[model samples]
Target: MSLGEDGPGTRTRMPEQHAGGTGRRTQPQPRRALVTVVGVVVLLIAALAFANRGGKSDGSAAADGTSGTKAGGAKGSSAASATAPTGQRPVTSKTAGIPAGFAHSVQGAQSAAANYAVALGGVDMFNAGRRHEIVATVYAPSVSAALQSTLDRAYSADAEKALGLTSDGTAPAGLTFVSRTVPVGAKVTASAPDAVSVDVWCTALSGLAGQGSTKPVSSSWFTVSEKLVWTAGDWKIQSSTQKQGPAPVNGDDQAATADEISGAVQQYGGFTYAR
Candidate 1:
């Protein structure tokens, strides 16, 4: 991000008059070039300050109470645990096999947002059939129908190519399509009896993980803010947006080989995140 500064202030000075019948004007020369140079210098300094503002990985997630990995929570902070348990069993019900019927509280809304983030960012989103089911399951009924067509266009053929999937969203033979988001924690930014906003910080791993793969699985950090509405007995997704990270510093761990990444993804099972 860059910062802009206002141009330097300028003042007009009155010319001097000599005490002679023949009137003459005398004035100090305006250092217009110096003023211009000074203004430019100030702007450059401001821009640099703004750019360097977010350069450090200060062990925090996004600004304003966003959940981030490691640095995001206090030491031993169950910060990930929003108001937990709602005295109800998790996954009380499922819509199209996606979790639904969350408790109508801040905790419940946070839980719903976290789980929906996983479903929305999953590899299933790449496949048309599965994507439709997932969207219908998670999105509000009022918007789901219209959103389907809009989403189909957004995730076009070119998008699939970029992800190493076929135009139809299938991975090539002998390859595994990987897309998973693990939520670090959830924060409720706003709430009401019928509407709520929750921010979920997550680490996502995406790309094809297989031998001879050109796009290998890699991780990215991001924050997703979701507006949810309570309707027809459950919380439904209204809208969401994602932004890049307050990512943590990389450790000195050795990088895994492509085969290793593929094997791990295949063998590991994902969890249903909740508050």
Candidate 2:
């Protein structure tokens, strides 16, 4: 979300000058303080720019409305249906990444929310570093510190041990720690120029699901409600909560092969939700 100005142009070294009649050597002056200040300022600007970026949103949904309410497509905008999304950016973040709002209108908040859902709910989230990255890139700055701290406590050493992983979330040899989210759909529950709320339905995979694994990966359907704010030039999370169900019953059909499941995870990529 944050963007920065490129570094200062190359410095030209000055020739040594005689300080006195004798070859009083002129020592090279280090621009350490200047460079440090420039670096800090650049980082600060980028952080502020990204933190305060504006996002588009519709005013249909209100604060007093019921939770889990869905907003219709026609009522929002025709921006998403105008063209197909290219690459991995999602049908949403068409011109920007990290939940950058749609460029055309104040309605792209739905898209930004959906794309962020994918980023937050991905399998990589289980990792401590990845979790921090998710919060930093997708969450509002005010809450990220607290959220990550809470997550750090909850995702404890014992939790990792139970999942057959080390304290840092690394899987044991010959095994993989899998926690992936596959998005099903997205909808705007509420929207505004500076804020938006979206719900995403998804299926998540956890555990190895292989032989000799007690925590065999199983599938569960869940919904995530994300409240976003326009900050630093992108939509950032204000808060989020999850719920179970709205999922369909499983058929009696036999489970797919392990290789089949793994292959599907690799071959079938995720989507950037919209509308």
Candidate 2 per-residue lDDT over residues 129-238, each given as its tens digit: 76677667776777676666655554566755654666665666655445555555555566555666666556666555345665555666656666777777666767
The TM-score of predicted model 2 comes to: 0.62
lDDT of each: 0.55, 0.46
Clashes of 1: 1
Tens-digit lDDT track of model 1 for 1-275 = 11111111111112121000000001110000100121111000010011211111122222222232222224332243333233434655667666678776555677788878777766666667977998888877777777666556656777566656778876788887766667776766655567766777677676667888886666767666677888887888776654457588978988788778777777766665556
Residue 87, candidate 1: Cα error in Å is 5.4
Clash-forming residue pairs, model 1? 59-71
* Best by the lDDT measure: 1
Ten residues in sequence with the least summed lDDT for candidate 1: 18-27
